[model samples]
Target chain A: MTTTEARPSKLTPRGRATRERIIQAAAELIYEHGVQNTNNERIRLAAGVSGSQLTRHFPTKESLVRAVIAWRADTVIALHKIPQLGHLDTFASLRLWADSYIEREELCRGGCSYGSLAGEALKAAPSLRPDVADGFERWEDLFRAGLTAMRERGDLRPQADPDQLTHLLMAAFQGGMLLNQAADDVAPLRDALDAALAHVESFATHPVPHDDATGGEAP
Target chain B: MTTTEARPSKLTPRGRATRERIIQAAAELIYEHGVQNTNNERIRLAAGVSGSQLTRHFPTKESLVRAVIAWRADTVIALHKIPQLGHLDTFASLRLWADSYIEREELCRGGCSYGSLAGEALKAAPSLRPDVADGFERWEDLFRAGLTAMRERGDLRPQADPDQLTHLLMAAFQGGMLLNQAADDVAPLRDALDAALAHVESFATHPVPHDDATGGEAP
Candidate 1:
């Protein structure tokens, strides 16, 4: 379904607020209990909206789930603030970005929000795969833009591929989070990011001095 | 729950066969449709076993899920045949191992079987986290053993940390497969693995000749 169909153009300010409230409630419920277990009734109660209101905003559960996917994508990008930072062209900024993700207590505990939603969507609602895929593509694009900037600025080798590197970084982050979820530890996440960053560092046009790079004492 | 508790000691040959059939059926069901969607009745029907027989083997759904996790771990190792090939000491063997996983059609379609189950189990059955973690630990150990062999054989640098590298490899794999599932494409999986392999290659004591390594014509 298209965005216009899912969200009618006739919404007043109050109607928009109500819709946002419902979507927020549904997103949290789905995050905690998964898509299969979270029903419209539960969402309605959680949102403090009536069944009719819920139905008015979302014609079907699929539409609501799609809305949640879209909402989550926006929320994730906002939370990352990568777009706000503009370009992650320098190695230090890249390291900072990686560290910011690693240091998040919520990620260590609950795993990546996008990944959790995507995982459940893949299983319970196969039809929504495109929406989930769109979310990931958007997220990857943010990184790809930064990496592209690096390549153009000559911080990366002339032949270094920003697109491929973006995929590698995203995979490492997603995979590390998955492992973290399974192991109930953050070490896997840390190690995975470290390895990916090292790989990226290998492509630096002028490698950072070892001591400056690692912050380690002189050998 | 402990293994001994999950699987009772006393069972005749027929009873054992029934149990195996039930687990195999449950595993397939879980693979095709996640843990939340696959019910005991469906598994029983698929296995062609009576309700009583199913209950006798796995009194609880949790027990059966655990059995599936155990079965999946074993099946994944056997399928890889890495242990049978002994050490992945040489870079060529490592490349072969990575290629074998990438070339699998089932992986392209269904994603990594073990990863799909783990993803579902993480969301649907939080208590089964330990079982999933144990399965991953076992899988990582297989890779760690190979890396350790490479280091001991002087193919890798003396200071190379097998444990950390194993984490990176496993993270890339799980992450790559997760991306593959979301994108419905194998390129992400390939890119992730290629990046991880390149990272691993950086540790080689005597780097494979560029021409011999990549099989590309001379520059």
Candidate 2:
């Protein structure tokens, strides 16, 4: 694991709020335009921070990226416990997750924040890579656990590889997101996810019977 | 398809060669550093072009990216028909096709040039999306074509959905690449590929007879 260090900074209460504002702006920008394409000046302008104030909080772009990743990490960790994932319909579970992903993109038109950060940090900030690695694997674990539960219920093929399926699902999600950012329309994502979920459906050993109880929505 | 008009300026022989050199260098840099991260100055340095000369040829960062994508599209379209894809060991075929994907990543660290360019040009270059769409669909075509060939030889289950399997394989390949990029290693690729191939192997309905002269790869 790379030893990541946040740059030193001090902020008053109002300053801290301003700093948070800067990060929120940065997160939006970085997700859409990508971290490398965005400049500190732009970030300062977006956050309504003076030049001195921006540097006083985050001295480097990398630090700003780390803050976004940390904040995103909190969201992912909070909403995506294994048990919580287990309770939702696979389609609905995925759409809820897509909320953060889609909202972030519209906010900045950047690629994914964690993905963009990880790509930038790959060479520039090695310390941040482990956080990226750990974060991605955590999502993989959640998917694997959820799939395992479904399989135990005799929904999936006996030989279905949960870990592999997890990787496939995550890949399509991110790849679709990446393409959607490029294309600016959400159609690629819709196609990729629809295709992926359809593949998941086919792998079930037993045909998925239609639920007659409250068929329109999940309780 | 959106028309992204890059000013490919008319050049003398020397100027043409230099422009090609710059495009090649930018391709390599984008592969390593990502599309947005590699700047005109870095591009100039890498291509051994003076800053003035680089800007003379490519007025915008987007122009340089456009040229790189044009260059790579040639490389990406290298899928000459392989008549024996199914008969060959699955791993061998995958390895042969996987190189450009990896090299493509090195050129555009976070994405395929198709992915990156279409992303940037989605609104401006709708006409160009098909090229990007083709790249996305190519892997599935290969997998589907291979499975169809296998079926002709009575090697696949009669009920197997080659089209769906191709989509699944495509997702797995893309996903595995994402994991490989994040992990900064090839092992995940190997592991993930192995697992997917195993799933494909399970669909083998007929054992290869020893009498076939070219079928020794599978046990």
Candidate 3:
């Protein structure tokens, strides 16, 4: 099933707004109620869209789920505006990025958007695993970019592998988010991020004399 | 709705087997299809139980869900019979425990059972959140016990607060599990566990002079 990209380009601006509204409402409903409990009919009612409108945007539940996955992934990546995420040249920027996620978790009182969908969708919607995996790949890319920048700038030691570290950081962050969701606290996330950041910090190159270069301290 | 404890004491061996079958079937079905996609009829069919028999054990879907949560929690904890978890007295035991989980993640081809359920059920089954949270607490207690053992043995430094480190380890493990689920690989889990174990190793105290005490190597 096609997602937003499948929409006809001949639509007016109002058409675009309505389509977005349906997706937004569906995302929130799915987020709160889960994919199985939330159906297209409920989405129609919640989105203030007619049956035709809902169908026009998402012809099937699979299509709608795919759209939600894409939409949520984009929203998550876009919201985390930081250097290492976008540039990834330092430990300080990585910490700032971690803080942003922790703060959002506090405000939202939910796990990662992609993760929530994934836990529900992976088994039930086997076809969409790649889409969810793609979302994660994109996230890893952000870290990879930052680490690459650090490597180029002579900040990271030669032994540090950005690709492996990127995977490690993403996994650590996802695991911490899961624990935080279960405990309804940020301690899990904080620890996981700290550990990951510290691992990355362990690779810092020391240019100064007799300097201890492990970036273990949280910025 | 009540859980397994609510069952009558007069049940024969056959009745007991049937009840266990129903829960086991429900857990597998839910694990593969999610709670929403798998229904009472499917569960009954899978368990080879009659409608009345299913209803006799779990009067409501919520009750069945609660039973599943309780059953799965016990099963997960019981299966991981390692140090700290089985016996948490040394860093070697912890490494062994980490290796066991990484292996299980590969065998199961899914994330941590508790973590997957927590993500999907936290919002959909808010009533069950505490049950899930309680499960995590039990897991954390295992870690805490291990850390406390290390401290008492003079393996850990005096500054290591088992409680805080317990929370950190749990969170890091959970985050890494989530990433592994998304990516369908063990690298994330390995990385996260390594990071956590290394951090824990950092807290080790050396009683012997001129000894390198950080138990950083994976067993």
User: lDDT of each structure?
Assistant: 0.80, 0.58, 0.75
Q: Report the poorest 10 consecutive residues by lDDT, candidate 3 chain B.
A: B208-217
TM-score (C-alpha, index-matched) for candidate 3: 0.87
Q: Is candidate 1 or candidate 3 better by DockQ?
A: 1
lDDT of 1 by residue, B30-135 (tens): 8877888899789999999999888878888888998899999999877656553555666776767777777774765666789888877777778899999999
The CAPRI class of candidate 2 is acceptable
Query: Comparing 1 and 2 by lDDT, which wins?
Result: 1
- Score candidate 1 by DockQ: 0.66
Candidate 2 stretches greater than 4 Å from native: A1-18, A76-113, A120-127, A151-158, A181-206, A210-219, B1-16, B50-56, B79-168, B191-219
Model 2 chain A: weakest 10-residue lDDT segment is A210-219
True contact recovery of candidate 1: 0.70
Runs of candidate 1 with Cα error greater than 4 angstroms are A1-8, A82-85, A209-219, B2-8, B82-85, B209-219
Candidate 1: deviation at residue B171, Å?
A: 0.8
Candidate 1 residue A208 C-alpha distance from true site, Å:
2.3
Q: Which candidate should be chosen as best, given lDDT against the real structure?
A: 1
Q: What is the lDDT of residue B59 in candidate 1?
A: 84
lDDT (C-alpha) at residue A80 in model 3: 63
Pick by DockQ: 2 or 3, better one: 3
